[model samples]
Target: MSEADSSTEAAPRGGIRVGAQKFGTALSNMVMPNIGAFIAWGLLTALFIESGWLTGIFSGLKDPGGWVAKIGGWGEYDGAGIVGPMITFLLPILIGYTGGRMIHGNRGAVVGAIATVGVITGSDVPMFLGAMIIGPLGGWLMKKLDGLWEGKIRPGFEMLVDNFSVGILGLLLAILGFFGVGPLVSTFTRAAGNAVDFLVNHDVLPLTSILIEPAKVLFLNNAINHGVLTPLGTAQAAETGKSILFLLETNPGPGLGILLAYTFFGTGNARASAPGAALIQFFGGIHEIYFPYVLMKPRLILAAILGGMTGIFINVLFSSGLRAPAAPGSIIAIYAQTPSDDFLGVTLSVVGATAVSLVVATFLLKIDHSEEMPDLAAATAGMEAMKGKKSSVSSMLTGPDHSRGPITDIVFACDAGMGSSAMGASVLRRKIKKAGFDDVTVVNQAISNLEDTHDLIVTHTDLTARARQSTPSAIHISVDDFMSSPRYDEIVDLLGKTNSAEGASGSPSDGADPTSDSATAAPPAGAVATAPSPTQQALAVESIVLHGTATTRDDAIDEAGRLLVECGAVEESYVASMHEREKSVATFMGNGLAIPHGTNEAKSAIRRTGLSFVRYDEPIDWKGKPAEFVVGIAGAGKDHLTLLNTIAKVFLDADEVERLRAAQTAEEVRDILTEE
Candidate 1:
């Protein structure tokens, strides 16, 4: 089961909320990739500016062309400093290029960087804002232009046309950026700067925390900090030595305080997990660890908001700010970016916020006297709902409990037992064996067949609710990708830790040798020739379709079903079941692929185990995600699972998928699927 399913089960989000998240994601994507450049410039500013620490260290030095004077952009050689050029040119170009790549690919990156130079040259101020705007715009324009002639050019003229088209489009976009976008964005930047100044002057800057804290929990921290604050903060830092904007969203105090509150006052799993979460939140700087806590009791958001305001108010009162943006918002990062004179102020701000948030969170938790333990899984679901994606870090709070005993029995559940579930089982079985956990047993089954006796239940995010209803006691892990999910690694690590802990008290179990001949023994010495396994007979060149014409998911599934029917692999009624299973839960597995299979109840329609493979020239929309490869499956017995596992292994590698996609003949496609 994959966690990558659409958030259809999450709370309803209006267009406004969805649009804001998408837009913010786009904006953050541009700046987040270029954070290294921002950090480099920030370090230079902190250490090399005229009032920097280096200048004070060499205060009495009299060398006019010394390294300090030359590097710091101070003394007699002030104009030659690298700091001005970095923020003015290098940072914005990097941002622009990254943003362009996000929209298109390498071509977009090239044109985006070229377009950014125009903005940098046109504006006297740093062009971070301009880069953000022009970079994606440049890429989008190139994408649209390419679409105009996509696949229309003569065979031999493609390279010539592509190169000249990019050159011409890039030239035009650059000129337009210089004459129009650059100056326009510079004005907007100034206006936004003045607004921040207005809020700061009135001592109401802390009020912004009301929005900031809530947004952070909703997974918009990166969008707010990198997209909005970093650009504004950089421009401000260029003028003054620092900007308070840098401290707004990066303050770890609020999150630290909430986790600390949970450590002391939280009950059940929430309390047990709080201490470790605090460590990650404060020092490791993953604020997401505490988000599920807030979602568990949404009123805790008030605690977070108040805590954030307290920190901002103290910073404002002391007129203290960091010289650069803190990437992770860790305590160490904050201190590193703090100017020497602002240490006391920064320390007090963190302390004050923690105290206030701790008090508020404690009060909230105490009043909720319900004996029922908070459902961290449900809260996690809510967080994912709000964020519109599964969070990799939040898994720590909801993962399998080692205290429940060793995870010996693991099961994978999907819409059908024979499709992706089997594939996921194979993937994890290999991983578990490699980690020397041969004592553990891994298997796959339909969600309806899930049993509470299992130690762990793995399922797609969409089927999680059903799996839980059927096997509520089992620790459930939801994933998005069956073949390559990080959860598999985390599970292995968890097993290692569990094994080591158990070893302290008793002799460890001598696990079964997975490689023993008994496990892989061949059939009895051949007395007579036998038929191949169902999986071996499943794929043929006749069953593989290249350059498929199915434009819609239903059409693709129907085509695949027709192939299975013609091959005598399944009855025609199984085709209808494939559609029925798809309606209940999409077969859109990740990695540009989908596996359309009949539901468990439709098993009687299958005459034999077989698979039909189809590769479309263009992507087919499978539940809003694109699917270029659709594998229709029918399994009367378990033999088909082996082929599905083989296919899963092939698709797991991106290079292999491309090779499969580029195959010119059905024979080539069949060879790729069946190859060892």
Candidate 2:
């Protein structure tokens, strides 16, 4: 709409201009996804707050469940209530699935939905906790099902199977849940609810909300307000059986502040959204809808939080809530719920909070952008193009041995030679030593010299051009931030590829670290360091078989033993103790992957062995995985689990995953699993 927006329409083809445009574009991109998630959050929040447990807690305390507990209120029952342990439990899955469809299309949409649904119907913890834990399990299971469809069946058939399977599965799960698991879960949930009642009834009243509001405005309030309460309010809506966030709608104290200031101050889209956000929030409870405004100018967010908290405190101290049992505990809803004498309190909360938010937003208007945002028009075009090339992350990987490692040489770079690149290199060095790559040398230098051919050139956007000019053929890696650079998949891959290659060349027959200290010395000046070959990467995979007495816990020990002599991995002594049957808890990571390992004790004939390249036909929950394939590592002295910090990298890379997923044979999988 403005010159900034029009000129912004150009493509981000070449050169670096990560100015305000980049920041602005990045900020804008967050809105759509955030809104999608926020909508879902609202529905879930409402649902949980209205659950039999939370409501019953309030009911016991004579709070009568607030308007949120009333029928036809935002927290009213949805048709799905009786269908499972809860009506709102599946909201995230539904949202996730819908979101996936909108973003990724039909292929992975249902999978996301099904995966998210599983979290609700299956997990017993909080939404976020469940999302962190159970969410991936569901996704892993879905992937396996996808694998079968693609491998044994066909793509067309696979899609058909997936669609019907997901729908039918959802229904079947609901039915079975009703017959078997649902009641038990509901009963427990109810008991938990009573416990909540006891805690709330005896300890503190809803007064915490009032105080926490003011408390938030001061110190950690922004996080508590947005990161906690706003989301919590949104979740309340979901829990209450609403689709959109109605809670935030009624709570415009923070947003209104931003908007009113703009009306009284200058004009800009950033501040402009504030008024609209306030308007919508005032009527519909879409509180999170205003996040963009505050996020763009976070200094203003504190003011907004302060206002909201004050408003809430005063509202609670006085009057709030009215009419339809509002979702956000809005002033109207409070007024509706309060006695006639307390009506003034609700007005005070609304007006007071609005006044505060306005002042802060207005104050921010006179300031210039501390970090300029990218021009939206060109940024938008560039983003669209980049989205296509956002790079599935696999293509850039040149097998596992990406760098010429053994670390006699290390390079750290930054945009300005001081900021991020320098910081990133420091981080990489720390991680390197932590991973037992101690023999490697570390150096910090800017990318200014054209002839400086270091093993690896780590540079950020600011310093990348210098790095490029210096090392045209040198392995160049781009990083967004210094703190995050070393962790980037590409950087890790480049480093890991080389290390794995070095380790692989040590032992040709077995995957082990075979390199001697002398072999790792500096390469001759004229000698060219070759990139990793497929065979070298394949040899890098490590195998250890733990044949200890089967523990009642962790299946890792047993699996490690079987894998040690992996058809060809060798040594029956290494694998003998693996299956000496015993049952404690299963090695269930709740997915298809497992770390199945344990201690190998003395005075026992049992020896430990760990192996690789055996794919399970039917997935089993090994160390919480349904994984048929696993990378097993074992050590005799120190705790072997320590290696997980590094190996976890294998599990995290999208590129590595693609390669691993594509493997059909044990050898093919081995090629991917090898340390590289």
Candidate 3:
């Protein structure tokens, strides 16, 4: 296989399996918006049928009246049939609504109706599966309208835009039902019946079973892109009657994929798009929908093709002749559309085809081994290294590493950038002012993006992998309890060591700008200031050392919780509630730390939690049992997301894992952190 093919080879629910949600969403998107379009189509088809437009169009076009007679497959002795009605009525509306939801997140009822109307009025060309373009356009229209109203659309209207409602929604639906989808659906129902009867015929031929899937994928794409859409547009005109689609016998999608899997892999991703293709062609006769699967995983193309040829072989051998197009040999619609009672033959061919396709696709996946995907962290960490990560906690925990910046910059940054970093800036700023050294200035940026203007930068941890990309030679400091931890020590020492050297080496002639460095020129206005150590001291650092390590993670959390409760910082129920809630989803914020907290806490329980730090020797599942340490807190809600902000202050900025790996003792850790 080609390298691209090897890598692109590509969730299971239940019997539902992978791609079920995608398919279901697609179907829903197609069906819902088209409700109104269906009504319009039904109305038009009813009018045209009664008016004899089909007869005129067919006669003028030299196509047989029989084709027109079967537009909806519902012809009476003197009346036009249901086939015409269904074509005019149902498909567009149903498909449009479903399409809207799939493409657009949520929708309003009025919006959905307007979209359905647009489809009813505009659909003339085929789209995704050689079906209607109206469905997609309608969705697009609703999405556009929604964007214009954005926040203006109230919750009630937001629900109405894409959802079902009773008054206006029901009325619109009723109109569609009476005049659109009902008629077209009824007529399509007839066509489906006839198609089933035709497919039920034919003798037993084994090879036909094998050819179904590939034939469906390849030919299905060919049919929808060229065959079905040709006569409708100039873009399509060039390909008209040029392919096997003219035969009207092929399923036009990965019908062959099914057969190959059954014959080869038995159960694999090959079946992913089969269910959709079967339903579409069986009842709707729209193909090409399965192209995404093959486009996504090109390796399966040949396998699908092999299955198609095999299906044809088996069908021919069995003398199985389907009167109407059958997407999959497996679907009953194919059987229903057949002309023969050799129903047994059609059934066998379909089942065998699917089994074959499954086997083939499954085998391909096994051989490729490209299906396994990596987790997000590994992928993102590589990305982080490229982007340059800064340590937020370091600057906040200690003073900054800058000699050219002011403390307020650090403070503003704490509110908008990193609170801990800003706090450090504040400490450093006050210290500078108190010491009569009004020359040092502190700057704050995302720990992920620290600036070089500051004489010093401080952080408790080294986001070096993330920050190193942009932060070459910038001073850095490590601190304790960035949000509430001292692991950011690397930041403290590094910035401390480098700040002075960088400042001296800076050019006074670098630029006239206040923050600019010019080795031969003057420092910027309000630039230099001595950050106060007492201010850093004033910001209490509650270092909860191991105090003697615990055995497990939960026990550690329990101990931490006990300490927090003892400090009168939080209610005991908070811990239990958080644990119960966390079971549904994980709360292990990695780095061997389990930050189990909540969005809402009892007003009485909220407080500026001094600190609840516990250590563990053996990790237990904080949430997933992958735990080594945990810090629990309950900062007062009156402070507005205080606990959340506090948590963010520490963990978001520091490389806690690396720091813990280096930290040996609580006091050493504390001294290392608080000393700055």
How badly does each model clash, as a count of residue pairs? 7, 103, 184
Give the winner by lDDT: 2 or 3: 2
As a TM-score, model 2 comes out at 0.33
lDDT of 1 by residue, 1-676 (tens): 2222333222343566655666677888888777777778888887888888887777887756588778877777777788888888899999999988877777788889999998988776789999999999988998788768754677577679878987888888889889988889889999999999999999899999999999888776767788899999999988898888998988888988888988888787888888988888889878888899998888999999999999999999999998878888788888888887889999999999999999999888888866565788788767766765456676678774456767778888886688878877877876777677766677888877777899888887667656665765676677777767888997777777665543232322365332221111122322112434444588766788887877667779988998999999899989888877876667777788898988887888888788899988899987668899989998777656556666877877789998997899887887787665
> Which regions of candidate 2 fall more than 4 Å away from where they truly are?
1-252, 259-302, 313-352, 360-557, 561-611, 621-626, 634-676
Ranking by TM-score: 1, 2, 3
> Against the unseen true structure, what C-alpha lDDT does each candidate score?
0.79, 0.41, 0.39
Prediction RMSDs, each to the true structure: 8.5, 18.4, 22.3
Evaluation by TM-score, superior candidate among 2 and 3: 2
On lDDT, the leading prediction is: 1
Q: Regarding TM-score, does 1 or 2 come out ahead?
A: 1
Cα lDDT tens digits, model 3, 67-99, are 555553434523355533344334434444455
Best by TM-score: 1
Question: In model 3, how large is the Cα lDDT of residue 84?
Answer: 37
TM-score of each: 0.69, 0.33, 0.29
The global Cα lDDT (0 to 1) of model 2 is 0.41
